[model samples]
Target: MRVTEDGRGLQGSVAPTPPLQAVVWATGYGPAFDWIQVPVFDAAGEPRHQRGLTEAPGLAFLGLPWLHTRSSALMGGAGPDARYVVEALLKRT
Candidate 1:
């Protein structure tokens, strides 16, 4: 695979490889959380959630940008958001 001249895209050929062993994708943040799929996201690829509670049930995401406030992505904010998610999880149980 090679990157486009613009460096904003990938151009490659998909060919068969040996049988599955494991696959590792390292997409370190930046609106590219493609690994999290299904009903968890809306049409815009943003998580379908309220606060930290995701639509996938039981599963939740904490510390995402603007999760509940401008500081939601901060370390300090994770504690509070985690508490909220824990409460929500308890309620669901």
Candidate 2:
């Protein structure tokens, strides 16, 4: 993968490869939450929540690492957390 800065933003490109079965691109980083100008994060910049429900009424997080349980970041774990958050969202409206 090749990344270039185009003044306005960064552009990523991948060189052509022979018939591929799988491709995995790892950014080697974590999610950025600084852009969220809310009091939902803790001192370490991690979102503060309970079972995916944040202190902020309109804000909620899903599939985050250990958002509720050990498997919170796994695909199978997402279903339960997603359902919980969705239920909370529906109740809000």
lDDT of 1 by residue, 1-93 (tens): 333345343344663333322222222255565644335777777776788676554556776888788877877677777777778777775
Judging by TM-score against the true structure, name the best candidate.
2
TM-score of 2: 0.63
| Model 2, CA-based lDDT | 0.59
Full-model lDDT for every candidate: 0.59, 0.59
For candidate 1, report its TM-score: 0.60
Predicted candidate 2 versus true structure: per-residue lDDT over 9-91, tens digit per residue? 22334433343222111112367664455577789988787877776554677768887888777877877877777787678
Q: List the residue pairs that clash in candidate 2.
A: none
- Global Cα lDDT for candidate 1: 0.59
